[model samples]
Target: MASIRISCLLMGLLTVFLGTEVHSYAASFGSLAHTASATATTTTRSVTTTTRVVRKRTWATQSSNKAFNINMLDMCHRYGYNVDGQFVVPEFMKLLNALNRAQCHMASEILYPRDYCLSIKDEDKVDLIVIGSGTAGSLLAAKLSDNRDLKVLLLEAGNLPLMTSEIPGLWADSIGTEMDWKYFAVADETFGQSLDGKKVNVIRGKCLGGTTAMNNMLYDRGLEKDYLYLESIGLTKWGWKYALKLYKKSEDCKFEKITTSKTVKNFHSQGGKVSVDSFRNTRTLGIRQSFSKAISSSNLKTVDYFDVKNHRGFVSSIAMIKNGLRLNAARAFLTDANRKYNLRVALKSTAKRLLFEDNKVVGVEFENSIGELIKVRVTEGVVLSAGPIGSPQLLLQSGIGPKSLLNSLAIPEVAVNERVGSNLQAHASFLGMIVSFETQPLKAYSISEMVYEYLLKQSGPLANIGLSSFTGFIDVNEDGTPDVQIHFYYYSEDDTVFMPSQLDAFNFNDNITEQIIDINENNDMEIVGISLLHPTNSGNVIIEKTDNGYKPVIKYGSLHEDDVTTLLKAIEWFKKVLTSEAFEKYGPKIVPLKIAGGPEPNVDSEEYWKYAIKHLTTMNVQMAGTCSIALNPSEGVVNQNLKVFGVENLWVADSSVIPRIFSTESSAPTLFVAEKANDIIKNQLGCKGSNESNEDDDENENN
Candidate 1:
């Protein structure tokens, strides 16, 4: 009877121990089986007895193992754990210790037993390979991949957009982060000098969707005359007729009560991939109505910005946003149908250089995600869609630019195109005026409340990009074409609650900051900015050899006298609108301009405005015209067909090939260029279902 009691006591103790172990395991990880089974086998020898206990754990699903394994590998790499193709106990213990130090609780190390450092082999050959999956490249890839007989490979230098990119109002937060190239231009004596005496930051998106992913979602198809000017300069194929068709083909405009004007109904297409709409249906914060009344008081009529026929009045700005989310180029063009079959996308792959065999383009060599060089062979051709600066830099790096530049850089010249990186242009803008209001609409709610509204209903102050609500185009030249674009938006002193880094991102000087602080200490403010649409000055983008790799040297040329003259006229026009009767209701007050270490200028003098222009002028990030199209190599880098001069099977289809700068944002025009390029490439390849005339077929028929 005493022996039986001792056995019962031992069993009770074992049960408590098992319960404690199971509880600890569950607490460290997630939910698991409530009971774990353990079997003990005992063997009695001459002098000793041995027992082996086997424990069984049941996982929720196979996907759980995969998820845990991925997390473990990520944690091991992040914490510097030595994972040399094996999952040993010491290495696992090191990972656990690091996780513990980081205050992270993880499941058992046995869950992730596979090696995570194994190499993956990708497809090496395709009919066509396009480098840089940006605004143009994404659409081009989708169109080219539509033909199942063709295999297309697209490579992007950056990864997919983060969750921050999906939020419409958090665009500025993405800039200068990993998603941006973060290029800085070489300071010019005329317009490049900022208040800090530093070069202006050239923010270019380095992600799959490119700049469209981070830009203020304005959906303006620049002035029609902008395209007509291109045709006048010898690019006859890029006339407004062709551009209009391409714009309609790509846009799916959703008209609502506020957006359904006669001009919008006639111009907007309904069945396209891209969704275009107005934020008035979502959130305008009453700024639209106030601005409309203000402009009207100054005798400026409110017209549709998309009228295409008229661009010289106030209009509600449209955006490339739908359902309160940013409709980026990737979402518009890179559909699942394209990826499911013939299209292959390589993200986080940097194109090192183009591969050539005796002047015939063959393949591309790029650095993959693992930092290993991978070569992708192209059977037909290779298209360079790496934007304005990147496209020129890649061409120069591949020995395809000017002979002199290539010789100086110790790169053998394959093509001597001197204009490969010349003629860079960007719109220059200046803050016209800042007006303080007694009370603002956006200041009514806290940032958390705005975010909550957006999360629940996808509508609120968070849905509006704070750049502008009402835009105005004016013909400073008086030559029938609008040469100045004005953007109007409200700026609450408390807006920093929503975007903490806004003031820093604005790159304001100390004097401007002090003025802003003084104004915000009392009341909210609104700002209006004017951009010179038709600047006569241009710039150039060159490459320099660096210790790490090739770096682009952007030279923004001196601002011309005419550019400043036009801005002066624009500022005068803005003053009239600011003092109109419409602002009387809001009791608007202008914040005086002050310069650091200098006397305050007379507000009405051109001299003072010029000082402000020099200190305040900045690029609106609408850079273009680097690798422009022309009749020959002497005049431009590529011909009207977008084929690189003196090179076969090489093409470029991006904003770089634009012959002239547009009077508005370049996103829509860039998309049009890519669509046109699709036709050009299809015709050249004689692919099935091509609507273009194939020269090869013509030759065959003649033979």
Candidate 2:
């Protein structure tokens, strides 16, 4: 009884740390005799008494000892909890290992009351089929299934998200993990040639929540002008007003600053699916504030980026985080939907091709986890929300692309639409700039200490990227329009874990990685990531059938001269920031990395900056434009309603429909698109309470 009580107490604590998933199991063990004694001790040392209780009340149970053991093992491996015996005790380690070897299901029974997936028969038919349980698909499927009469099937290529994905700061660590699709850009001499193997990695989350599960959770709605450009380019109804309505409908803004700010109060809304909040407590708060101060000192206005009136300014970012955990699309939208009998989620199921009959998509063929092909027919329609890369690749697999390209691949052309895989645009940035500070403003904690703080209080350096939250949108062209988005990353001395992911994400060469590691080892460093909001060049995605499956071959355009100039201007803007009064006290200075086998140009010269920018250019993975939206079939793949031109009951709802690249991250915009798609889908299905857009509603509204 004593041993069971002790083990159960540990499991309870694990529940508290692991977020809402297994939180109920922890509460269930609150009745144990030993829990009271351990609770005070753990709470006093790691978490505030109030925070622990509040989290307990907010979360419910769903887990087992096996789940606990595995997740604990994951935590140990992921965050260096067992590194150098930092936080490990010999007896406690033995208990964990024993639990790992034991079979336990009762905790899981309580934690997860029911399985989310519903097994479907091979020839089964549903009212609607939604491919890809990504940011868009998750919400779209959830909303579609809300009508009890309609049956919705959501197929995901990957399984459910892991417990580690809940931690906000660990988002980067998942770049090359199992949860990521791990798509690498095909080698190009003219693009990303300086990087390792002349390749740049494209990150797409393979799990249920999709990229939202593995991404930096910054919720940027993009500039109002970006939407106007969409409207001008034939996406007539996707203007600022319609877009904002969808944005507010999907967002549940929890950011006190934004909610309270009179300037942007009306811009945000309450009680929506996606919870948006500010990083309320961060270890490097001082550094973030100092950088914001530096922006003001540089003569740039510091205002809420959410406010469209002052859209271009410096401010700490608002993220899709709730209660210190990552609230991904699945968590926010699909969790409750799991209980709905009308929705069936097929996890680890890859959609092979769309089954088309006379220009109508009637069904879909997918490969299940055990390598079996299953065909499911759709009665109402099929929506492809498989992201820009996946959706276009799938379309090409089903022979809906350029005829010449399809013929080259020996694929039977189902629908010849020349624009199926063209117009790929992504936000590229220069990661070579390193800013050094003489003294560190925040005290660095050991891995064990940081882990404890994260597990207990859910507040610390591990809780959020400190200086990274503070970003600036600067007007590089001096036209009063922001041209670049500046992202800042602070690395404390001797950080062994963080740099690997950063290097791997950009696929930086060994020489550059070594230089960065060396600089980080000696000095408190800030990596200046200057991202071009709009680029002159565009790329395309093509499919190459492999023994395993279809692989997307991204043909990114060569770097344009205008794009390079924009980055150069951004670097100049950053120079002003470093020299500002706020940074003077910290003695901030630029530390340039040597290019591998390049001309020895003066570091201060334009030629050197241009060379560096070219060598270091990489992407933010805000990929879009494939399967673009247009007024007609001659112009693009999809129409204003996001319906595929040549097919009936077929639509594309992901970032692939964005006709042009925008000035911010794509997640929030993707959610907005999904919200609009949901209403459109619901209205088509004759579902009650559908908030379909009215073109006349925005007629009297100001632009």
Candidate 1 wrong stretches, greater than 4 Å: 1-123, 195-197, 257-266, 281-285, 297-299, 337-339, 441-443, 498-500, 693-703
Global fold similarity of model 1 (TM-score)? 0.79
Give lDDT tens digits, candidate 1, residues 1-703.
2223323322332233222222332132223213233343311111122433222221211122332222545434443322243434464455345433322111110010111111324437788988877778988888888888888888888877654565676667677788889887887656534443446778788987888888878878787678778878878777766666677677888756324764445556777877888776334535556667777754557764555666778777788887777778887787563334677887778888888888888888887888888877889999999999999999999998878899999988888888989999888877636778865544354333443355445566667776464678887677877888887555555344322234334555544644554555456776667888867878899999998579999987677888888988888877777677766666776665776544475667788778777767777778888889999889998888889988889999999998778878888888888888988898889888776421222111100
What local lDDT does model 1 show for residue 629?
92
What is candidate 1's local distance difference test score?
A: 0.68
Q: Candidate 2, residues 224-262: lDDT per residue as tens digits?
A: 788779877866678878877788777899887778876
Ten contiguous residues with the weakest lDDT in model 1: 105-114
Candidate 2 Cα outliers beyond 4 Å, as residue runs = 1-118, 695-703
- Measure candidate 2: CA RMSD: 10.3
Clashes of 2: 10
lDDT of 2 at 337: 69
